[model samples]
Target: MRNQGSLRSTLHQRGMRMTPQRQLVLDAVRELGHATPEQVCKRVQGTAATVNITTVYRSLDLLEQLGLVRHTHLGHGAPTYSADEHEHVHLVCHHCGAIDEVPCELLDGLADLLAEQRGFALDASHLGLSGTCRNCRENPTAV
Candidate 1:
């Protein structure tokens, strides 16, 4: 889990002013990890509240710019926004499209291989990982 102060510091850096809409979007993102802009708006609307789709998208872009969020196409569409910033791999359920994250050790090997074989400098934090989640593993026929 990330500390609230860290998130506040990041918002402070960008001089992002607080808004009820943005706060609702942020809360939705924190609750539902790896979601699309449409998904975010839907989640926020679930509490008998309303926010424009444009507002949701704008907030996501702002968050990404501030490095407070990261995105990947783990599910579908352009990319999914996630509040967690840890360098981990995403495991997506093929059946339900559910997403889960796990620590990634792949970068260590890739880094070593690049240095030893190709002599290249690469940062693998931007890499995206995708696979089946545990539920899919247990229910193969669901997909």
Candidate 2:
């Protein structure tokens, strides 16, 4: 979780004031690890029933703009948000719909290859690789 003092300072630096709603939204994102905006709104509403989804969306956008959080598309669904410092590659299982995280270093070779061949800098942490997980691969019928 980011320091509350720093969060306030960062918002102040951007000429924005930190409200309780924004703080709750940020807290929800850090606590949930990765969540959609609706999930974030639900978590925030748990603490403050008056907080709404629109507030959560605006807060997420502001937090992302400040580099305090980042979003990644896990599948065809809504994007999931996570703290900016939470750096890792996401492994999404297609059959079971399971999500796992691996160190970003695991993609070093791919990143290098992309950079060399296509001049494309890969943001490994911002990417999700979809495939069958070990469990699903081992037990195809289980899915």
Candidate 3:
């Protein structure tokens, strides 16, 4: 679990002030581990002051720049946001579009292997590993 207060303080450390919109956005991100901008805006604006999509985008961009938040395009066009700063990898559910993060040193070794085999340094930061999640497995689609 992520500490909201500490995560808020990280904004101060980044020399950024927290407005209601930013806080709301951050809270929504913390609530929904990896959410796209639209999802974030909908949740943050729920029962709160009206917030535009641009606000979500700007906040996410600033957070990502400040290392207070992590995001990945994941070939989905829309970016997903995470508030946890600790290095981790992501598993994206292709069926339901859910995202989960887990810390794995083995992923780092795979990065090393890629570098050695292909001379390609990988940015495995919040890597997107696409597959069906457990939920999807349990509730397999009627194909």
Candidate 4:
């Protein structure tokens, strides 16, 4: 999770006032890990007693713009947000709808290959590679 101090400072530098609502939203997003705007609103309201969904959505957008959070469409569902900044690859299970994050370095060989052979810079962090997980593979009917 992102440190609250740095997030607040980033907002301050951007001339964005840090409201309790915004803080609550941030906390919700961080705590919820990869969560949608609706999930964030629910978490925040559960803690703070009141919060608007629109406000949560707007705050998420602003936070993304500020680089405080990252979002990715892991499957057919809404985009999921994460506060983790480390480079990583998202492995989404097509069968059970489970998601796992593997270190970005795991794809270093592929990245280098892409860079050398295709002259393309591969950002594995932004990718959500989908496949059937081991459990799903073992039990084809699990899903």
lDDT tens digits, residue span 1-143, model 4: 56778888888898887888877877887787778888998898887766788889898888878877778878877788877564578899887888888998899999999999999998777779999899999988867
Which candidate has the highest TM-score of all?
2
Residue ranges of candidate 2 with Cα displaced over 4 Å: none
Give me the displacement of residue 118 in model 4, in angstroms.
4.0
Per-prediction tally of clashes: 0, 0, 0, 0
TM-score of each: 0.69, 0.97, 0.71, 0.87
Rank by lDDT (best first): 2, 4, 3, 1
Alpha-carbon RMSD, candidate 1: 3.7
Off by over 4 Å in 4: none
Query: Could you tell me the lDDT of residue 24 within candidate 1?
Result: 73
lDDT of each: 0.71, 0.93, 0.77, 0.83
Candidate 1: where is the Cα deviation over 4 Å?
1-15, 93-98, 115-126, 130-142
Two-way TM-score contest, 1 vs 2, winner = 2
| RMSD per model, one decimal | 3.7, 0.9, 3.7, 1.9
Q: Which candidate number would show the highest lDDT if scored against the true structure?
A: 2
